[model samples]
Target: MHMDEYELEREASAPIDMLETYYRALGWEYERSGEDEIVSTFQGSWTQYELRSIWRAEDQVLQFLALPDIRVATEKRDAIYETIGLINEQLWLGHFELWSASGLVLFRHAALLEGEDGATLSLQQAETLVEAAIEECERFYPVFQFVLWADKTPQEAIAAALIETQGEA
Candidate 1:
């Protein structure tokens, strides 16, 4: 499946409420995660699907979306690839790839889609999401840069990578 490409623009910093409102206007449901994070869910049979945005201590904004299909827990290898393709196309991202351990599909900008790492969404759309997330960070905290990721699994490989790196260091 091939994903669609969209453009994202950065916006002024604001509170999560503002970001929630923006996404809500786009027909997404918002749920509060931690003190400075939010998970936005898209409506439809695609329930349990959510986008998470986190504001770090230094004001860095991290964003990503998770799409899970529990029914494919024990499917074959090719099925997993097909699932990845399906998600890539549905999200309209540039590219999608599979993760080894968790079997998740990561989406991001095509440039970052290399290796056995994350996937790539359209840089344009990512810029937009980051801009929104940045506004929320500025309102609630102090945000520096906006980081975004997308995956078909509920687990976050980026977070896992951070933890592993920290432990190793």
Candidate 2:
């Protein structure tokens, strides 16, 4: 029996199946890392990031994470912390956290898609969240560079990364 994408699995497998199908439909490069996870890479102007998403069927949640291997000197961690605090405030979705052990900064977001029937994970929501994550990464990637390489203070790095939008018709 053939099933439409939306109605493929109402309550069968985990949400990863729906997410996998959606990624294929969009022609994105992704790999099914496991039965419940998919990893996809996206390139921004400054660098490329691998976005790993996992489906937690039991919890009825989908979590997305992107972390690039950026070297952060021990001395600069404080600046990065301050910058990310300011950055998180400006972000409409998702947030950044520093994995101090590995010196890797991570961006994370999640979507809850469980209801009475089964799951409501949609292609639009998946795409929108991923796009938003990437955009957020692109928007703040320069801040890291400024703080680490240029030795800019946290405030200066944030100011440099912000893009002021002017109203223009």
TM-score per prediction, in order, is: 0.39, 0.83
Best candidate, lDDT? 2
The TM-score of predicted model 1 comes to 0.39
Candidate 2 runs further than 4 Å off: 1-14, 163-169
RMSD of each: 17.5, 3.6
Q: Candidate 2 at 2: error in angstroms?
A: 9.8
Q: Tens digits of per-residue lDDT for model 2 on 1-169?
A: 4557667435344467666776676677989977779997777777888889888878878898987656677888999889889889988889998988977888999988876787666666776778888888877888888899999898887776664211211
lDDT by residue for model 1 (1-169), tens: 2222221233323334445555655666678865656777543232233456554434233444343322223344454565445334534333345565665543322222222232323345444664443322222110000011233232243344335545755
Name the weakest run of 10 consecutive residues (lDDT summed) in model 2: 160-169
Q: Going through the candidates in order, what is the number of backbone clashes in each?
A: 26, 0
- lDDT of every model, 2 decimals: 0.40, 0.78
